[model samples]
Target: MSKVRGTNTLPEMRVRRALHSMDYRFRLHRPDLPGKPDIVLQKHRVCIFVHGCFWHSHPGCVRATTPESNGEFWAKKLAGNVERDRRSALELAEMGWRVCVIWECETRYTDALVLAVNRCMKHSGPISL
Candidate 1:
């Protein structure tokens, strides 16, 4: 568990590089923000979270499978992660920030991920649900 990373992960780096190449400047994990979003575009008021499929319990994701041993513990831990994510996103939305979650599975397709980020940045106002 100690080896696991919470920030500057591969997926996060990929997204950051892609966005930077596109001339989109962003802040990294601003402490004042709810959940301290991984990528914060102050100009666009958009916050992006590059989440691991397993840790965040991505719905229907193959990597989200729980371990056979210590299933109860893993289940609780993952559930808490999901719940915390939901709460943080909601709080950010309430604060008029656009929240975007880029799942680890989606990072495999760089083109699609870049397109999604572009769309999110272009979007104006608070996200609808």
Candidate 2:
């Protein structure tokens, strides 16, 4: 678990790279937020979260498997992550912020990832990617 990273993850980096290429600048991990969002666009009232399938327990995700050993611990940990994410998203929404979650599985498909990012960015403004 030591190798597990919570920030600057592969999917996050891919999205960051794509956004940067498009000349879209954003803040990384704003601490003031409830969940410390991975990317923040202050001007657009947007925040992005890059979640791991296993960690966040993505619904219907095959990668989100319960550990055979210490299943209870894993379950508790994963559940907490999910609950925190939900609460944070809710809080951000209540504050008029748009939240986008980029899952680990999404990284396997760059085109889809790009489209998702573009769609979010569309609400902010036109960007060249």
Best by lDDT: 1
- Per-residue lDDT of model 1, residues 1-129, tens digit only: 999999999999988887887788999999998899999999988999999999998899999899999999999999999999999999999999999998888778866676666666774433221
lDDT of candidate 1 at residue 115, scale 0 to 100? 64
Each prediction's TM-score versus the true structure: 0.90, 0.88
24: Cα error in model 2, Å: 1.0
For residue 101, give model 2's deviation from the true position in Å: 0.6
- In terms of lDDT, model 2 sits at 0.85
Give per-residue CA lDDT, model 2, range 20-65, as digits (tens): 8877799999999878999998888889998888889989999999
**Candidate 2: where are CA atoms >4 Å away?**
122-129
Question: Once all C-alphas are superposed, what RMSD does model 2 give against the true structure?
Answer: 2.3
